[model samples]
Target chain A: DARVTQTPRHKVTEMGQEVTMRCQPILGHNTVFWYRQTMMQGLELLAYFRNRAPLDDSGMPKDRFSAEMPDATLATLKIQPSEPRDSAVYFCASGLTADGKGAADTQYFGPGTRLTVL
Target chain B: DQQVKQNSPSLSVQEGRISILNCDYTNSMFDYFLWYKKYPAEGPTFLISISSIKDKNEDGRFTVFLNKSAKHLSLHIVPSQPGDSAVYFCASGYKAAGNKLTFGGGTRVLVKP
Candidate 1:
């Protein structure tokens, strides 16, 4: 019955505002991923962390976006000076491990945070 | 430069029929492939997966077929029910490349009952 949980399921903000999305991964999962979904681009990997350490973030924009996993249970993605193009659904997923060693072998997703920047 | 592609934007099928969703990939190194189903306002949920070494894997009514030579894979749902209506996304990843999945734009399936 364990599942990933995300807060601020819906967010509406003006352009140039700052937006922060939070995720609580499933207990005992060692890998976490952040993705952005848009009609044009589909699901794009923003960043990912294994054992609370970021392993890849090349998919993310360097100027105003950042992702962090401060602890085992929490992962956060922030967008400073958000623009209209940043409006999309942000998803958080967790797996048991980075590689297949301890992983359940599949990523479980949260309800996702829908962000609308005007 | 989309690594994965689901060409069909949407499909409509009658209930009790078979639903076939197709996906093609450009990355030859993609060793893992997955299919996910998404409803409006909800996150995409993992439906099934197949490794590059295998050509087919099935769970209940769902089956995934991979053709490495063609770099194509497919998901087939038999006796499709009304509940099977959702957006289906195709994703591929290379385990050696950090396991970050590259997703397609998704195909919306409407099973009319």
Candidate 2:
């Protein structure tokens, strides 16, 4: 069975440290999404890429957070000088779209990376 | 402003009973809705989905009902099992947008055996 895989299932870093989370989307999936889950905010989309191209990152903090799909197989989210408020579970999800399947498509998520910034 | 809202933060139900989770949305652009279930320490998984054109969709023990006029949707799980304890999230999105969803605050359900 195909699944999305995320590295660093757990991370504890001091504030102001740079944290990088990696995700390997299921092979053959064309779209990748990055989401953050927090107690106060619930689950929110940070950014997403379609076919290795950045589609939208409006929900992400451009000053400190950056999401990129260096290639089709690898998608990365990096936070420079990460702060305490950045502590949350970061989830990477992949889905098959681009064929106009739009709303009918379902996203397959990876075991999220739990980030704890002190 | 949260376009999608799950008013109930938690629900408790006995095993073999019916569990209902409701979600309401304020976005008129959303023509499609979906439900996702998340277990502790795990990512949310797709549960069920319904389009504005359809009033209801059913799969196995899970049923999703959509009310476009009321801008509401609900998920029904019959004969709930202990394993059904998890967080359920309701999401809405536009058909024109490809797979990007606006999610509501999840409801934590506890199924007592």
Model 1: per-residue lDDT, tens digit, B1-113? Answer: 98899999999999999999999999898888999999999999999999888999999999999999999999999989999999999988876666578889999999999
Q: What is candidate 2's CA lDDT for residue B75?
A: 98
The candidates' interface RMSDs, in order, read 2.7, 1.8
Question: Which candidate should be chosen as best, given TM-score against the real structure?
Answer: 2
lDDT of 2 at A41: 97
| Candidate 2: TM-score, chain B only | 0.97
Clashing pairs in model 1, backbone N/Cα/C closer than 3 A:
none
Which candidate achieves the best lDDT against the true structure? 2
Q: Over the stretch A9-118, how does candidate 2's per-residue lDDT look in tens digits?
A: 99999999999999999999988999999999999999978888888899999999999998899999999989999999999999988574454367889999999999
How much is the lDDT of residue A104 in candidate 2? 39
Q: Mark the 10 consecutive residues where model 1 chain A has the least summed lDDT.
A: A96-105
Q: Deviation in angstroms for B79 in model 2?
A: 1.0
lDDT on C-alpha atoms for all candidate structures: 0.92, 0.93
Q: Please write out the lDDT profile of model 2 over residues B1-113, one tens digit for every residue.
A: 99999999999999999999999999898988899999999999999998888999999999999998899999999989999999999998886778898899999999999
